[model samples]
Target: MKELSLYLMSLLYITAGVNHFVMPKVYLRIMPPYVPFHKTMVFLSGIAEVLLGVGLLFTLTREWAAWGIILLLIVIFPANVEQLKNKKARGKLPLWVVILRLPLQLVLIWWAWLYT
Candidate 1:
């Protein structure tokens, strides 16, 4: 179960990272208007996610990778909040899923902390 969770988490990050480069326009569109340098932010975030994802796959840097992921999660949280707010306004992304993700972040952080 633990291994499965780790694999899924790693895969999720890698997929998201790839998307940041391959489909950056989508990500850019979602960025809150107040943020500056949207394109640059997307590119940098992509690189970070890819590195973190690759690191998580190897035992040598798993702890550091987990820590990185936790930090990344914290850093991107405001965007998540903004996404949820937008979705709420649009009546998209069902309320239950949005609510569920709020606590899931904590769980993911705890999981990362444990790995570290």
Candidate 2:
């Protein structure tokens, strides 16, 4: 089950990372205005996500990868909060979906911490 979770997590992040490049505009919408260079940040984060996801595949870097993922989750949290608080930032997402996403971040953090 642990291995399965890790595999799924890796795939989740990799797919998300790819989506960052494939659909950059989708992410740009949710970015907090205070953050500068939304496009660059999106691209860089995509690389980070892909690297961290790939790193998880190796025993030597699994813990580090997990830590990196946790850190990424923490770093992006403010944006999540912004998205929930500013309905316009969330675009078409229903209020309930935005609300539910806040707690989901915690779940993702916990899931990543399991590797650490």
Candidate 3:
């Protein structure tokens, strides 16, 4: 089950990373105004997610990958918060739902920490 979960988590991140390229507009919408080079950040984050997800597959890199994932989550958090600030980005989602989503990042961070 642990291995299965690891694979599932990897798949989740890998799919999400691929989505960065596939539907970048969705990501671009939530970017904080102060964050420079929005496209670059999105592209690099996609790369990081892909690499870290792949890294999780190996014993040698799993823990480091997990830590990297934790860091990545932290780094991207502002974009998540941007939803609260930018209602247009919120895109009809309820304010409560957007607020609730903030904790989801911590949950993801915790999930990554499990592998570490």
- Candidate 3: C-alpha RMSD to true structure equals 1.1
- Top-TM-score structure, candidate number: 2
lDDT comparing candidate 3 with the true structure: 0.92
Q: After superposition, how far is residue 24 of candidate 3 from its true place, in Å?
A: 0.4
Off by over 4 Å in 2: none
lDDT of 2 at 78: 81
Candidate 2 lDDT, 18-112, residue by residue in tens: 99999988788889999999999999999999999988889999999999999999998887888888877888889898889889989999999
Question: CA lDDT of each candidate?
Answer: 0.81, 0.91, 0.92
| lDDT against true structure, model 1 | 0.81
Model 1 Cα lDDT, one tens digit per residue, 39-62 = 999898988998898889899999
Per-candidate TM vs. native? 0.80, 0.95, 0.94
Ordering by lDDT: 3, 2, 1
Candidate 1 residue-wise lDDT at 19: 91
Worst 10 residues of 3 by lDDT: 8-17
Q: What are the candidates' C-alpha RMSDs?
A: 2.5, 0.9, 1.1
Model 3 misplaced stretches (Cα beyond 4 Å): none
